[model samples]
Target chain A: MIAALLESFAAAARGLPLTLAIWGAGVATGLALGFVIGAVRFFAPAALSWPLAAVVEAVRGVPFLVQCFLLYFGGPFIGIDLTPIVAGWVALSVYGAAYFSEVFRAGFMAVPPGHLEAARMLGIPRNQAVLRIMLPMMALAVLPSLANLAVILIKETAILSIITVPELTFRVQGVGSATFAFAETTLVLALVYWALVEATAVASRHAERRIARALAA
Target chain B: MSAPILSVRALERRVGDVEILRRIDLDVMPGEAIGVIGPSGSGKSSLLRCIAGLDEVSGGAVMVEGRQTRPGDGAVGMVFQQFNLWPHLTARENVALALKLVRRMPAADAAAKADAALARVGLGALGGRKPAALSGGQQQRVAIARTLAMEPRVLLFDEPTAALDPELTTEVLDVIRDLAAAGTTMLVVSHEMGFIARLSTRVVFLDHGVVVQAAPPAALFGAQAEPRVRSFLQTYLDRVAWARDA
Candidate 1:
């Protein structure tokens, strides 16, 4: 029993790097994409904002599993082909982008249009005003939500195993089946995810403290 | 005689079906403070906003220093009623960051200039505090410092004291009064008639989206004022008196 448990644990641990890679890629790309969409909605005309809004809505309203399957399995219909790993990253990014955009939209809105107008009225360049005044405030407001999304993406990576991405869940499930150490494998899987999430929380908390100190009145 | 430093010709503003301002024309010579006064819904703020490019100009032009200018032409600066300082940054940072970003000043130069601007506004010691830590009056001064550091050719003040109480109003008004005395070349829209009568080089009265009168303080507030202007002033003064007594 002890040997089987150790074997399953090692197998699950082996998938850690791949899991982190997918999660990090999805989050980084999603955050960048989300920021663009959120800002477009805030600064652009209704015509542009409306279409982006629709895309965000559809991505958010649909299940992540369905999105992953449709993109991976249905890609050939549109002359698109991606490896399972790439497909999982893309789906996770889409899912994250949609959710993170909503958080960002609220953050940007909270900064007030007056700040931009004040900057403009003072002859401050538009980009400088946004980069300096608007973005910093928006970043502070959205940090907690963004961190939450980062952790959610970590768990979302486990779903990638369903697409045969050979991530933690896939490897651990294989070990459980072959060695009949289902209970031990499940415990190891849970512990790994817990650790990743706790680490994310700690990092986020640290950043919040740093920023809070800087912003202190 | 010097040509007008700022000119607004046939300015017409329409918001949906309503005409907020109609065919308004005016000019401000250098070293002059033009006070804009009117009843609520009388397009007083709209005129300032139109010049600042905060509001789209439906018709007409705003010419500053012989050039057609919009916002950020490095010609116009406006102090808002709300004192719209970025809440997260220190007062000094608020002033310095704009200088760095817009003027391309180096960090040391920006910080030095920011301190000087703050000192000019009597807020030198409060420079390290954020807007939230400052009083409404101090925040407004910090905002003025931020605008002043930019050194625009024209300043448009949109009821700068409208958001403050009587005591706080006095603190901010003193700073602006000094600015006017120093010949900053600006237009001020305000309800503080006493301050307007005292500080303005000329006063423009707007009614029904039109310039009812634009005259020196002595004329606009004098018995010889236009009938509409006279009646409006009488009513406003009477209301102020009533509020004070009540």
Candidate 2:
């Protein structure tokens, strides 16, 4: 069983690069989209905010797996075609973005009005105030939730296996079936995911501490 | 001779149907210190905020240095009751940010001026500390330093020491006293009657968004003043005396 597990690990390791790529790209795209949409929700004029809120609400209301299926399998009807990996990227990013936007909005709302009011009274320009005063302060409050979203995205990458993306889960399933070592292969996959989530949590905790200290100073 | 450095003519502020301030007229000349005194919700801070252009006035214009100024115009600066220093910036950066943004001073020059401002507030040694690390009084002083670095034509302080402990209040008040002595134009809205009595060249007493009286403290505090003003003072003095005894 040990030797079989080692073989499964080696096979799964080949899938690590692609898995990380999807996760990284998805998180980056998601965070960027989330920030923009969240800002619209938080500070944009009412006319602009309502529509953006509708879009965010629609995306979040659907299940992640269904969204992935619609993007990957449902695209041909609309004459929009994407490769399995690209579809996986879009699906996870959109899903993650829906959650991230809410987190960012909450963070912005959490900021005391006094901070921005002071900035205005000091004659700081609006753009500079948002960048220097609002966003950084919001990040200090929202970062842990963002880190959690990254972990969720990392796991969500597994769903891409159904679309024939050769991610960790896909490769692990292949190894398990070929060798009939389902138990060992599954165990290794779980351990790998556990490690990833743990790393994310630990890193975010350290970031939180550093930010708290800086804010306290 | 010249127009008052900062002037508010017939200012009115309304939120929905509620009137926060009404037909308020105030003129602040160079080297003059005017204290605004009133009970809570008497439009004291509202008047200050309008003069600073922090809030929109439904009617009337605020003229800074004899011309209308808008928000972010850098003509006026205000210190808040809560010492609204930006938490992320250090003391030096907090002061320097205004200089850099409003005055368009070069970074090096801004930093030097920030240091000078901090020193003026007796916080030169703590310039590197963030507001959260400082005491409440120190934080308010940093806020004052930030406004000073802008070199605004008039500084409006909205209950500047309201959030401080009695001991801390003096530390912040001392900085204001220095500024007042140096002939800085100021409009202060405060509940600290003693400070108002000591520092104001003229004091305006407000009630229900109306100026009850605008006079020197001696004129307003004595039995010779209007009955309402005298009554308010008597009540305020009694509260202060009770607080002291407690």
Off by over 4 Å in 1: A1-12, A40-52, A76-81, A175-195, A212-217, B225-236, B239-246
TM-score of chain B of 1: 0.96
Pick out the ten consecutive residues of candidate 1 chain A with the lowest summed lDDT.
A208-217
- The lDDT values for all models are 0.89, 0.88
True contacts kept of 1: 0.72
Cα lDDT tens digits for candidate 1, A93-160: 88999999999999988888889888877667788788888888887888889888888789888888
**Cα lDDT for residue B196, model 1?**
94
Per-residue accuracy of model 2 over A1-217 as CA lDDT, tens digit each: 9878988899789999999999999999999999888888998899999998898999988878788889888998899699999999988888888889999999999988888888887788879988888877887889889988888788889889989899999999899988999999999999998898898788878888898776655
Give the per-residue lDDT digits (tens) of candidate 2, residues B18-111. 9999898888778999999988899998898888777889999989877898766778878999987878889999889878877789999999
Residue-by-residue lDDT tens digits, candidate 1, B158-230: 9999999999999999999999899899899999999999999999999989999999999899976999998
Winning candidate number (lDDT): 1
TM-scores for all candidates?
0.88, 0.94
Candidate 2 chain A, run of 10 with poorest lDDT: A208-217
